[model samples]
Target: MTHAATANLPFKVHDIRVEGLQRLPVEKVYAALPIQAGDSIDHDQVADAVKRLFATGNFEDVQLGRDGDDLVVIVSERPTIAKIDISGNKSIDEDNLRKGLKQAGLVEGEVYQRSTLQAIAGELQRQYVSQGRYGADIQTKSVALPRNRVELKIEIYEGKAARIRDINIVGNTLFDDDTLLKDFELKPSHFWSFIKGDDKYSREKLSGDLERLRSYYLDRGYINFSIESTQVSVTPDRKNVFITINVAEGEQYTVNDVKLAGDLVVDENQLRPLLVIKKGQVFSQQLVTYTSDLIKRRLGNEGYTFAEVHGVEQDTGSDNNTVDVTFYVDPGNKVYVRRINFTGNAKTDDEVLRRELRQFEQAPANTSLIDLSRQRLQRLGYFSTVDADTPRVPNSDDLVDVDYKVEEQPSGSIGANVGYSDSSGFIFGANVTQNNWRGTGNRVSFALSRSDVRDSYSFSHYNPYYTLDGVSRGFSLFYSKIDFDQTSVASYAADRLGGSVTFGYPISEYSRLSFGATYEKTDITTGDYVAYDIYQFLDEYGDKFNEYKGNISLQTSTLNRGVLPDRGWSSTLGLEVAVPGSDYGFYKLNWSGQKYFPLTRRWTVRTRGEVGYGDGYGQDKSLPFFENYYSGGIGSVRGYESRSLGPRSPGMIYVDNGTVDPSPDPVGGNLLTEASLELIFPTPFAPDSRSVRTFLFADAGNVFQTEFNDAADNVSWNEMRTSVGVGLTWLTAIGPLSFDLAKPLNDQPGDDTEVFQFSLGQVF
Candidate 1:
């Protein structure tokens, strides 16, 4: 072709026009144009604008030309996403994949970016590979449709999971293979031994197990223990993987001597007692840590806010089996609290939080004070989280400001429940309560319940901190109607309306004493042939049937160590006394105590016991049925139903005949005592989450009349109602769920004990 010789002539653009603009406004095109009406166009600017337009991923092609002093911009828009299809994902369902892609900003009707599509494909492949599908293939295809949209299809071919062929452990002579294997969840099955069963493997879980093993050895004084190497290999066929762990088990050492070093604020003699380690003893990291904690705690109590104790070991040249330990104390600058701050209390008042703080501003910042402040806040139950940190002042190591952040949670709830029991069938109840009423550390509740045997409604309020120094006060009003088939006394039905006010005084942080009085009016309907003695007493005391009762109780609780409790103990003792001369005149006392001790790192032993007694006076010589103690079930004996283990009535009374004593002899109404021992084990599944606990328990208890002569005697093996069972306790969102499968060691005639019992909420 011959070229025209017009290179020197002026190049002119005819016009500038825009096409294929739907969502793109006409004004946008004009704004992007480089050449205005009557202006010469530059080829570089036109090329740049065209590149910018195509970079938006909104157009497939762009053409720029000139028509007489105007630039012509023509574009072909890329197709929008119309449909998405996914297939061949069994391990990961299609819906989940779609959701994942959607979260990554992919959806129909949006402009499709090639980079984003490629990223999605890569992510999908990675997920499949993680699931052990090494040979899996993923391909994505797009089809253009009408209306400038496209459809996408993702096809996957996922093969079987990669199996584990062998797991080999080297350089361990202390424990056998079985013991080490138990720590690992991976195992080889008979059919797939070559591939190690193709089990689903979790790298995180394996890492955790290795850490556990390390800690297990370190805690036993193997301080130099180390993992040499870890290797995982896959077979040529990609069907199985082999794991190998090489470890270096250093020599076990014993403590030769323990000495203190550095600037010690406390006397050496005083500090030596706190060190739990002893000479010639098996060196234990736990003991060393315990001693460090003890020193820290003592220093904290003395207002040494910034104190640290580090246990250092000096190796002796004796076969590498012995070491002398020294505790080096670094007493940093004594920190003083410049300020205390609280945050995240939108609903609660600032004063409510300030009053609970044990550590005050302008005071020495001590660890114990901060811990006590945190506990005080926790006891209010207002906040779900309370964290304290000492943010040091800039350029001043001695000055620090404490920040106490609290996260307030919902303190009110409306709950309804329906329950059934052999004694009280079809029980239904509901309640509305606010534990932190108006953020004042008070409780208010309204409850209504109805059952086949009883019906009641009650309103109550309590101020946990009624006084500035920590006294509590409470008041309750209730109306109840009870129908009883009293075989021991008489067949009668009574309705009562009552109210009571109580005041509780905290003798100390661990103990409290409470006094309360109630006024109740009871209307008893008797048969024509009622018992002569009861009829005479009631008739003589007519209109004076209104009864008044008063009670005084003392309760105490203590925990030597509150967190990570292993050696210390917690106990509670309660004694309640009812005054004489009241309508139901009797003196009742209830006492309970619990203790926990750790025998080893993995073993914990706990013991608990409870006793209840009542003595009658005046017209009534015994406790009322409502006031009697009933034992059995998870909280009590764990082998029987509530209130069903004592003297029970045989049948209902006949009004016309005034027939009493339903059974040949009643066996359900009596004072009770119980004792139990438990061994608790921490679960390995979720160590940090204290949601579940496993326990093996042995329980023994019995119920008897107040006048029973042998009440204080030690229960013999034959006399004791013993039960052995394993319990699973789950700290659920609602409350703790205790499920136990118990078998009674000794069974009496006509006993209908259940083989399994599942209960919700704490027994205490």
Candidate 2:
């Protein structure tokens, strides 16, 4: 009945009756009704009640009637969602689809609205389009269940992404089309398009490409260059896209004058060196912006944390295509850090994180110091990510609080493995390591390993902040049973037990000095074919000996990263000497260094050098043969067998048979030298991966006997072996895997050469 016809009718309800209610509770229906039983209701009131019930969205139909002065309410409840299933989804994960459905109010147990299904389909199509899948199709279907519920099945057809067929650039006179197109990430399909995937048409990538195109011209003095228009079209089958970029190549401009204006909190002479822009140079947007950042940072280093720098250009009235540029600097009030807070470090103690901060509370808020603090925390390997923020306190312009947010990562490893390596032969090992043991900023490690040539067990512990002044203290206990007879280089075996107490003091931000005292006892044994030098040493020094050694080392590093450094250098100097009263008195000197220079945005050049010399002193006659150095393997020269690059041992003779058998094992030497140069490259397959490094390297090194044997000559430069190789290292979930293919350039007749070498679970 019409509301107008029922407006004049007034009725007093005796009771309320509900019908056609399937899932909705009767109490909920009563709550929605404006006129209940025992309340005098008019037709206007009944109309309002019906309208309110429909607004709840819980019913598809609501009907109101009166019989014998009793109000009757009938409702057809909306179906509850039973389940949601997604199919044919490839690029987008199923979980993401379910999350989108939930966000769209289509989750299970919620009321099902038919309009929502259509909206979800549209949204799904939009997502596919964003990924260049213009041919994607989505369809949704609902199946009714027994309990007034429905199940939604979303079917998705993710077609192939549209490939870029061609890109046309118009109105380009200053630079060639090839040069301009090189700036764009999107490209026309070429022979390598399938592998690179840059031929795919994506809006996000297109936007970035356009920005690069603008930056390319802007950096070159084309101050007025502008992109007139950009047009993108799709093929009929939706399999290909064509892009067209139109531009205006404006007149090149030159700088007439460069000046500094506004607040000069620092000496102008000091700030002038920071400006990259100069008079008579081409107008460079990049240089201007870089100069601005430099000025801001210079002020920031001086405690002006809120400094603002801007560059303004003024066109000259003369028609010489010249402009005058001015840099405006505003050095706000000097900011002080009132408090330093650590957050999101649930497992780690606050003190552990606080100790890493270079910027302290109640000190000047230095930007570089704060940045260095974050970098130090990240280098600790305890957290996956670290972020720092300095926000001013309310009503205090000069007082700011620094906050450090850290995301804890797994810092402990308990691993056991049975494997084989080219250098180690068959191996089995188990190790437990905790870099942040119990969140106390201490390191503890225990390991036991057995190989065909070596067996060892060791335990070590280190505290980085032993005394809170950045001093490190550690100790190690180790015992090794070495069977050199099973190895390719040695014809002897030894059982050794050793312990060391080590201390490290940080001399500066990038330098450390370390001192270590070690006590070791070695019991030597000769095999059936022992080298003559080994037999002679055993005869002179006996089969067992005790030695006490002390070492002092100094190291400095400015590397940007630990795993894969793009730029920086590190140098180390070490001296090791046996105690005066030891069985043998000797001193060893070593110097090593490595440097990395960034060649481009994605490539680097690295060089490494090492030199070592050792000799007897005081009462000793000769340096111990067991302490000699051998150079080879992946750690040294890649194309060579481990420890096989030294002087040969004199042949051994047996008296039992009137014939002598020669031992072909290598005799390690007291002098060692090595150098390497590498050109590091990026991996194409994993462009965004930081743990994978590929490089091409040339290496030269050798071990030379100085006084081990009378027949062996002194070290010679011509005796240095050389190799060239290409290598790749990948850090997988299990461990780092390294692979190398090398070719020896200058190989001696007795030298052992290997073209291919690989190792697992090892750092190179």
Candidate 3:
């Protein structure tokens, strides 16, 4: 509606009117228009009004006309989407389809645009094509509805993924095609191709395979190896794919000499020892990179936080097939910390974190100390992420600020559960724990539970930094009452009350030594079907007794995380002995260790072991049956029942006509040994979630008695029971929940086995 297209008349409009509007408010059209009834206007204003109306995306066409010096605006409204329907889609879920439609401006109740829908359909088809489904097709149509509304219908037919038929490797002599393809994920068609479908063609998988090919050559001294080309062709039917690769492998090269270049800042003699490769060794790209990293790290340790190192290989003429390697080091200016800052600790006190810092303000910036400080914060079991930054101060080449940012995890957890199980009979419990109370780095916990056969209550408190040197002090009290009238173990009940106090000394950053003293009093009550072993112990040591004990232990850990740690190892060895004048005189030695190895980005391998042996000193060289160790169930062997995998107790029997009566019950032994290996993997479909994990494990363990009447030998590996299972752990807001499904591999005739077990607890 410009002067060239319409009558060139510049005059003031007397009024404004809208035309061809339906199912739309007049105010909307007027709001989009830039031209209004004004004192003066021109053809340029009319053109701007039409452009603004079209820019609203609510109209199919917009035009301006004049009638009696009044402006007349006309528009054709686009059809509004009434509904959406989809069919023949399996690979893509309904939620993703709706999300895609919404992103592409084709959502229901929005104005329909044919071009946008058509373009989205093509983009979706390309996604399938990338997955080797070249025959996939997408069809879209809009059905007319009443009042100018339309229903969008999208149909997707996702064809089968093309299978790999064959693979060819050209220009490779030292390594055969079969040898190179052995490590590839994509393989030729085999007998199980139709069933497994793992041999299906994938562009990403082929790319990885090609990188592996390049690495295979580069690692074996082929310095000039290069891939000429790679071609993947699909059949006309799009049901099969063929791949071919051409490569050039240069002559193998060996290192003749190694030297250092550039400004190392540190002494050359000290940096020379860090070199991993020397003369007469084959050239290796991986070792070269590793050596470069080591050099950079050493430079960082010497106050140069922004050091750089690179390894360059030079040809040693054309005769001997040798290359001289040199590392170029650039140690940037030594920086000093101007200030130290901490953030993201809204709940934790700054003093609690500052005490763990190895780096100080107004000191030379040491990168190693900064990283160590971050690790110290992480190991506190309070924060999920600890990040450190040493950025240069404004316009200062030798000054920087050490800044630490931490995201605190949930240091407090509440757990409560109500359920009924036949074995436990109406089980219910609640637990409250706080590892960092009021941001003082103190721990407090309380627990209470009741069941048909058992009742327990406990309370505890600990201060991790009682003094400035990180010494710890803690104490706990517990009371329990049990009646085992309807359980798998010996039929006996006991009422026990105990309390303990402990002091910890930090031996190093990763280890601690602890000493504790305990006092316990126990009262026993026997049932009609009580085992003879319980009765014998009661008769020898009296029905009730007060015990005094002392324990000393040393523990060490380098775990990367407090909960579900993904790396590092931990170990603890302890000795507990009964004090003089106590009713019991036994001493126990226990040791346990766990190590985690990261296998991949999402997979880890964990190994663990535990062992315990107890025996009395003085005249009484026999261990009390109450101090015995029992294995199996949730925290032990998994498949077997709780405390149900040990020597059987000889029950009291009444002989009739000189025939011995049968009496059998499980009685824990004084010696315990166990070992476990697990493959920790990310939870399926929720791999990005940090609060959940899954693992598969194999466990083997058993309890044995060294000086018991029914003892067969000191120890026997053949008697050990083994189980394999899959488990899942979820850190919910309330607490941590774990579930295990296991199968026993060597269950005996009388062994009790449980296929499933679970525990939900709050760790403090």
Worst 10 residues of 3 by lDDT: 652-661
What value does the lDDT take at residue 172 in candidate 1?
89
Which of candidates 2 and 3 is the stronger one according to TM-score?
Answer: 2
Give the C-alpha lDDT of model 1: 0.70
**Reference-based lDDT, each prediction:** 0.70, 0.85, 0.85
- Once all C-alphas are superposed, what RMSD does model 1 give against the true structure? 8.0
- Give the lDDT of residue 612 in candidate 1: 75
Which digits, one per residue and each the tens of the lDDT, describe model 1 over residues 191-240? 66454443554455567768877876776778788999988777888777
How many clashing residue pairs appear in each of the predictions shown? 23, 0, 0
What tens digits encode model 3's per-residue C-alpha lDDT throughout 241-335? 98899999989999998899999689999998899988899998888888999898888887787888989999999697999999988888887
Winning model by TM-score: 2
Instruction: Tell me each candidate's TM-score.
Output: 0.66, 0.82, 0.75
Residue pair clashes in candidate 3 = none
Name the TM-score of candidate 1: 0.66
Give the TM-score comparing model 3 with the true structure, all chains together. 0.75
